[model samples]
Target chain A: MSTAYGVAAVVLVVLASALIGGFGIRLSRTTSDFYVASRTVSPLWNASAIGGEYLSAASFLGVAGLILVHGADMLWLPVGWTGGYLVLLVLVSAPLRRSGAYTLPDFAEARLESMLVRRTAGVLVVLIGWLYLMPQFQSAGLVLRAITGAPEGVGGLLVAAVVAVNVLSGGMRSITFVQAFQYWLKLTALAVPLVFLLLAWRADGTPGPGAGAATWALPLAGGREYGLYSTYSLILATFLGTMGLPHVLVRFYTNPDGRAARRTTLAVLALLGAFYLMPAVYGTLGRIYLPGLRGGDMVVLTLPARLVGGVAGDLLTALVTAGAFAAFLSTSSGLTVSVAGVIGQDILRGGVRSFQAAAVVAVVVPLGLASLTRPLPVADVVGLAFAVAASSFCPLLVLGIWWRRLTSAGATAGLLTGGGLACGAVLLTLVGGPHTGLAGALLAQPAAWSVPVAFVVMIVVSLLTPGRIPPGVARIMVRLHTPETLDLDRGDWRPRSS
Target chain B: MATRHDDASVYERIEADDRFRELRRRFRSWVFPMTAAFLAWYLLYVALSGWARDLMAVKVLGNVNVALVLGLLQFVSTFLIAWAYSRYAARRLDPLAGEIRAEAEHEAERERA
Candidate 1:
């Protein structure tokens, strides 16, 4: 509603982030601190940071908007997102931390002993990072346009600038503090407004989501074609996809040990479960209150002003606006750090200077992509990123950790096939536009098929090329599975050439 | 090449140890089954939401339907499984793994010194 409040919120968030990041930089002096915070972050702080980075523009703004439009079925997106972390907790988290890798590529090289596998993983990390980051930038533009009426490009530019400055100044250590702070800020931003909105609804006699819109309240009752298939595909993508996200996986490396990693993941589950509760509140309320509203993504921003009109409403709107900005910054910062880490270690010299340079490149590429590409619904693009991740990295991480017979050729083949197919499907959906019928539904949500194919190909190829298995497989397995508290001589798996 | 061969054999010896096998078995037994159980439970919820719309729409509480309840239960089960796993790891998985790790470390030190 008011540009002054919105602008002030944005400025304050930026200043706070920069301040926290600068403080973190002062505390961090070594290369290890810059890369993984010297592996000293505790469970609660790391969990909060994970929640902060994980709850992107898609979760903050898009989930509510989708629910506003699609109703009951849209709940699955958030459910699948939370459940994805459960999958991570059970399968990936502790072992990944125990792998002692700075980035996914490090894990790949260390596990498979193949430069090719490492390079392929490096490429996928950048690809997924860009795919995930584009939405945060685009949504930054959208929210800024909604709040202050700035040109779309300016908002993206502002976010890119802030994220770059933060990442360059402090690296992972500072980014962790910045993100952990944002998680609490975002929770309050949504939760406070929700209290008043619920009270307002109560004062107005608690109406349902309008009379006789039966399908709106019911999950698959919506007349969209191939609803069952799309739902299942979305479920598969998110449940498996989370472990593969570049930023998310990198957070595990910050945990002090495997035990802390598991504990941090449990905390993340609780934090996310609490935060996800508010979005549906905003979405369902939007239906009952602002029945005629279009651009569903704007519902969270617009609902406060519409339902609670006045200075208080403006203030609430500003709070949520600031939270939205935080979402963009935290997620973008985490993504940039992970992408930069991979690029620094793999492409340039492995040092803080290279990471700083890579951070700029990481943010710049996504900001450029954001400007060039037409914006999709923020959540859908994010889901596509997850699908790509599920197809590629999920198989790699799961098999690489547990399956000793996995060979370099197998991993290389699986990464290309799965990542390539998922990326192709995503590109078709984005550029070729929407299609009808079975092919369209399959293209729209590719994870249901892509994930299985990736796993099978990985297994078969590994079986065929059994001789290519790394000779140190037993040692690597012992390192990955054992408790870090153990006094065993796990090989020093530092970032290469650092 | 000789150093690499020795390292591999040492790790292979540890891997073949009965205690190491027990540790591996304990971990796989807990995680694999739990992973499968939770995934199956979650998929069942998704399936019901998709195909059993009429059933999901059945109101358990005022304006709260089977769909909403099932979705909330997914959250509950996630937290529950997380808590259960942490407990299980603490009691069963961690101690044995620690013992194995200590034994392996001792063996390696003896070999070196």
Candidate 2:
């Protein structure tokens, strides 16, 4: 009965997200509307949509598990993830809004004055999108395995189909609404049980951290030097990584102006920070209450039942199951939008057909990967995604925005140098064979070194060859700087060569 | 020196619809340097953590650990930087951009004429 209820709840959220998107298809008429929602999303709506997608499988399932295993130190995952946006808001949000870019590749090519840079960026965007999406797909399998005891493939297929249905039917216009709705659904689902559990705790005189929980909290991992290295590297990846995330950066483009973009980012910080806090509470609670339980990732799902213990426990569990599924559906849909967009533009011949085809690839490729690889712990998989973002796109965005001297050769050099190695390390980490201390460190925490090498390669290469800067630099600058409501509000997405 | 005529010509060009022109110029000033600033900030972060070993230990919130605090500040700094960009653009750069945009449009129209 519990499994059936959970599966049913999962189906409901997926259908709902898809249905919302399908409805948007009705309003989506123009190509622009299809791609950028006609640039009409309100700040609140856009923020919620961003949040819906941002709180991926990691936020829903993994944070608590990480806390269950690692203690307060794991709080960094949610904190860093939420905090990354603050970095994005400051570094790239407003200027990015000014840049009038349809995508990350557009920003890079125009900024660096090189088509090569754009292509490299295009490739990185797809890679980062895939790396990030893999976890969401894996989480789906994990969720189904927990609930239905079904083969992993069944859940991955189910989520992929649901995502494809929503994305192809509406493009971004529809997906935006679906994501916004899912954000609230995820929050409510997580929040309700938290309230009940807290009440239960109060009635039981507020329990203290247990032995297993206390150990998880203490940062005691034998070797101090290596532990320090691990801590710092993880920080580097998550902190700098947010600026380059395609979905997050894409939201700034929807805002009316640079100021509005910043405001939207602020809204997201508060929203995400609030949502993140609840998971820590679950994790802290899990440490005391559910010690020695395997599959810590299930901590979020298992908490209510462990605390309350009865018919009410079953009810709360069902609610959390629904929310976890919402997290999977919401994030998968968000990733689908970016992956589908890239494929449509770069690979497909006709735009709309390409979009539909791309949507299928977006879901299918990751689903296949999820089936083959036993998913890593949710937060850990998300961490790998961050390392890639930090090494590849972060350098590109930072340099592209402010460095007039950023040449295509430099970008290509850095991207290949930094991105190639990081890609190898990530694959090694995901492969799950021969995990040694140093190998584990390199595979798990490559960003600290990788990000710099990427940046240096771009700069040095650009300097070695003094070449023509893009003629469009000045004109593009004007578009990016001008506020939409200002007298220069051309609102045109075209890049002009001056 | 043909000062009067040169000054008059310059004044005439300025008086024409080039209000947004300044926006791009101001943007160029900020955008170029800001990129450098981020690179510096990123390097500063890596260097402080990797090479300057003892620095992050200069602590803040108890068990909140200074290293972790500084690391978290990196994220905070990103938000502040983005916010600063918006304010600078909205107040100074955007206006200049509008002037340039108008000048471009007007010039394009004149060429057609």
TM-score of each: 0.97, 0.84
The residue-level lDDT of candidate 2 at B100 comes to 55
Alpha-carbon runs more than 4 Å astray in model 2:
A212-215, A218-225, A468-498, B1-113
Q: Report residue A473 deviation for candidate 1 (angstroms).
A: 2.3
Scored against the true structure, residue A249 in model 1 reaches a CA lDDT of 84
Task: Looking at model 2 chain A, report the run of 10 residues with the lowest lDDT sum.
Answer: A489-498
Residue A232 error for model 2, in Å? 1.9
Q: Summarize candidate 1's per-residue lDDT along A438-496 as a digit string, tens digits.
A: 99889889999999999999999999998999997877888787665665455657865
The candidates score, on chain A by TM-score, as follows 0.97, 0.94
